[model samples]
Structures are given as C-alpha cells and as structure tokens.
Target: MDTLAIVILNYNGQSFLAKFLPTVLANAEGYPVYVADSASTDGSVAFVRTHFSAVRLIELPRNEGYAGGYNMALEHIQTHYGGATYYVLPNSDIEVTPGWLDPVMKLLDANPQIAACQPKILSYAERELFEHAGAAGGYVDWLGYVFCRGRVFATFESDQGQYNDNQEIFWATGACLFIRAELFHRVGGFDASFFAHMEEIDLCWRLKRLGYEIWACGQSTVYHVGGGTLHKSNPHKTYLNYRNSLFMLYKNWPADGWLWGKFLLRLILDGVSSLLFLKVGQWRDVLAIIRAHFSFYGRLPHLHRQRKALLKQQKAEVPLYPHSIVWDYFIKGKKTFEAIVETSEK
Candidate 1:
C-alpha cells in the first residue's frame, strides 16, 4: 500500500545486480523494491534471494525481453500491490542517486496530465557525459529518428547543467521511468512485440495520443551502463533497433500519405546508414539493417492491424518534429541538441 514501487527487470544480469543493487536499495526509501527476474540462468535469482532478502522477487517462466518482462511484472505489481500509485522501472545496471525518486514522484503528483517521467541519466562509465539511452529526455524527428536533449547519433553532450530544468518531453527513458500505475494499464502497457528497443517511445507516443504528457525530472539523476542486455556494438542490437523503430512508426503514425512519405525517407536514411557501415567494413551491421527492412515489410499486414487498433484509441493528435534530424545533424553540422533547437527556432 505504498505510494511508489521500484521494479528492476533482470535477465542474466547477476553481475549488474551485484554491482548496482546496493545503491538502489540504499536510495529506495519510502518505497518497496522488486527484482523481476526473466528466467535468468546466471544465478541472478539466487543472488538476489540470498543477499537482498528485503527486496521482493517476481520470477518469470522465460526470458521475455524488456517489453514483455515489464508488462508481466507491472501486471503482477498492479494486481498484488494495487495500492501503489507509481511504478519506477529502473534498469539493473543503473547507479541511482539518493532522493532520485522524490523529484519525479512530486512532478507526477503535481501534474495529473503527466503519465510518465524519467530522471536525468548520466553515463556510468563516463559520469560527465549524458547517457545514450535517455539523456535529459527523449524526442523524435518527422522521420521517426529518435534522439535526446543531450545526445545525438553517436554523440553525447557533457552534463554541464544546461538540461537542469525539469521540462515536458516527448518520451521518458525506460532506464529510470516513473509512471502512473493506472495510466500505464489504461494505455495497455508496452507493445510486447517490440521485445526490446524503441518500446518506451511507442508507449509514450500512445499515451501522448491519449492526451497525456511526459516529462523529465532533472533534479533526480541516475547513472546507467547504457547497454546492459544488448550491447550497442552488436549487430543484433542494430537489427532490433531498426526493426522496432519501423514497427513503432507503423503503429503510431497516421496511415495516410504522411506515413508512406516518412517511411520512404526513413528507408533512404537507413540505406545511407548501411552504406556507412559498409564503408567501415561492418558487414554484419549493414546486413542487420537490410534484414530489419525485410522483416518490417514482411510484418506489414500485422502491423497495419495494430495501427488500426491504435487509431481507435486516439483522443488527440500527437505532436512530432516537422524537420529531419538527419539533415540537421549531418548536412547542417549541428552537433549538440542546443544547436539543433536554435537552428529550428531560427
């Protein structure tokens, strides 16, 4: 019957658990913490049960990845601990700061329209740099290209207090997300089909369509080891990210001329990315993007059905950037987020 509950999802991340659990447990005052284990074979369950006995555990039958695991865990939390007003989904590899939850919780309580928010995420390895996952807050371009306020493609801005103000954002990072329990279920939770990347953005986009806002609680901060489960360098990670981004676009975007135009533009961008990888002799990465495109095309009928279902849930038109991030970053040489914003305004 607490006001907040922290649920950390684990899948063969015993090392991460061992390293980061103490900080989470230490900072988790006035709330309960649970480790939702998705059939971890690395003795993560045993480690938690033995060392962190105070933390509750939810054991899943198989590794359902991030979207599925969280969906399952949140369902359990809502059903069993219905009294909890907020659910904090922090990655297992995050080193949370003390009072991290207060700012986000206060923001949610103060604003009834905000369905979710995230703390400022810094890099665990290089603490001065904004983490790739969710630096300050998340945003997307017209072409479905996702970026953060402090991060662009392969470029991260240093934490220089520029993004210190709490502000409304397109999406909150799933890394240290604090969401309203009721609103989360009402949005039908995350699309489990995502299975990994871009799922949080999809969920936030859905919430936005329903006229709910998302924000960033910059006062509350956390350091995340960017790629705990799937390393950024992995070709499979590239495949999932590329494919899921397309899936998200298909489901959320209006299926008119706009959708096709954006999809074509994204395809061109993806081709350029593939050629860049080819130039670097990253054959696997190039192939991953190609495979991702094929998979997306193959799944269009199913995704179209999902798109129709999502349209039925729309209460308001979601906002999106009219400009292309690729043109801004690559063609115009706008490196930092501040520069991008400035140029857009001009």
Candidate 2:
C-alpha cells in the first residue's frame, strides 16, 4: 500500500494537539504521523509521549521557528520513512474532517502535474466563517501581498458554495497542505530563510516556476483555529511577515526594476500607515512597523544574496499582469492598525 507522512510542527501547542491529534490520527489511519516539536517547555512533548506514543516525535534542541521545524521533519520523512508518497503539512491547531484526506490524496494521484493540493479551511471557532490567513486558496497581488479567495483582511465571508469549484491557485495555505514528496524535495522544501511566515508562498512560487500546478481540492475540508500558537499582533510575527514578503517579491519578480519599484511603494505605504497608527495612539503597532523595517534592513544583504541565487536559476515567464493571478476578494479602505487589532481581539 502507498504510504503518507503527516507532519505537524508544534511549539507550546499542547492544548491544540490534545484535541487535534486524535482527530487527525482517526482520519489519517495507516499513515505515519510525525510531530516535530520545537522544544516546547509546556509539556507538549511529554503529553505526546504519554498519550500518543504511536506518534513519531522529534524534539528539537531549540525553537527553530515554523519553517525550520518543518524542514527538519521533512528530512526525516524523506530519509527514514522511505515510501511516503505524500507529505501533508498541517498546523498543530487544525482538525481534519472526515474523508478530507481521501480527496486531497486522490487529487494528487489523479493529477501528476499538480505539485500541491490544499483543502477548504474553515474557522475552527466560527464553523461557518472562513479563516483570515488562508481561507480557500491563496493568490498574490502585483505588490507581492498574498491573499485568499474566500476571505481577505478582516472581511471573512461564510463558506457557502462560494469557492465550491475546484481550481488552480497561485499557492496553498501552510495550515493544511498536501504535496507529492518528490515534488516537495525537488523544490527544496520550504525556504528556511523565511523562518515562518509566507514560506508556503515561496515554495508554491518555485513549484509553479518548475511548470507544476497548485490546486485547491474543494471536496476535502479542515477546520483552522486561527492564531492558536502565535498571537496575530505579535511583533515577531510582524517582522517575519514584512521581511519574508520582501524576500518573495525580490526572488519572484521578472526583473530588478520590478522588485525595487514594489519595495519603494511598500515603504511609502508602510510609513504612512505607521504615522496613522501613531496618530491614533497605537504606539505599539507603530513601533512594530518600525521594528519590522529595521529588521528587514539588518537582513537585507543575506536576503539579497538569496534572491540573486534564485533569480539566476529562474527560466519561467513571470505574469505581466497582476489580475492574472490576484483575485481581490476583500474590500479596500484606509484603516488603522489599531482598528484591525480591536476587531481581531473581539
């Protein structure tokens, strides 16, 4: 029988895993389940050992962040697990619904050209609503901002046959993505430079460049408890999001001019945004933006080197028009960071 390896990256997500593991194991029977824990001090490793000894656990020496943790686990899945045809990367905070795995695996089996397939992810807390991070499928804008089909920003719509149609997307959410192990290895897995945020987008972009398609399997579904591990407003999260976004733009743009132009636009927009946040007495958010930019500057040289190497190997045609890949499903308005924070907290 063909084998599958389900890789879950954990970091003090014991509460989430306590509920998620059983459901995943029940649905993902006959597959090798692996948990790559990032040295959680909250008894995450001990809990797994006590309750789910069947799960192959690899405790890291330190917190290597999400991308690094997954990469470490991917290495084990490939080398040790041997016949793992599919590698499913699910966040520790998600619950897999019944019959979800079959559709995802079936789609991959049917379409050999598809490098990855993701299930429809609904919010775990609000069953009807779509999650903020990656609702249905992922898309990228001209300025390198990534969004999804069913939801955008704070405007999440209920998933009621809106994205029922199966289609190819620019990328899939890292929350619950399944890919052919060979294709994943061919793309060198998630870019470790990302550390955490937007790594999936970078991986999917590389897969597309290699002449492979990323599909959204509408039939399969999973529930995502958004921001279960990292709070949405964390400054570290902000830094990674900003830095990795810039890295993605630099690496994927057809030319250097495009990358520079986007960078300038982002800087101007972020500056204005920071000023507005400061005006509204949201000094913390203002500082977050400032710190994000400063962090990006500190890592610019390393990012540039990586971008140069990636661009040198690219032979695929970059889409000239943004609308070709970006579908704007969210409304636009000038909103302060404070407003977003307040709304999310509610």
lDDT of each: 0.91, 0.78
TM, every model: 0.98, 0.89
Off by over 4 Å in 1: none
Least well predicted 10-residue stretch by lDDT in candidate 1:
254-263
**Which residue pairs show collisions in model 1?**
none
lDDT of 2 by residue, 1-346 (tens): 2468888999999998998999988888678788989889999999999999889898777887878888777887667666378889899999898898887787888889888889998999999988876788887757676667676556677888767767888889999988888878766888887889899888888888767889998888899997877788776676677778777776776674666777898888678767877897878877777777777787778877877777777767545225312122223341322233244355
lDDT for model 2, please: 0.78
lDDT winner:
1
Question: Model 1 scores what on Cα lDDT?
Answer: 0.91
What TM-score number comes out for model 2? 0.89
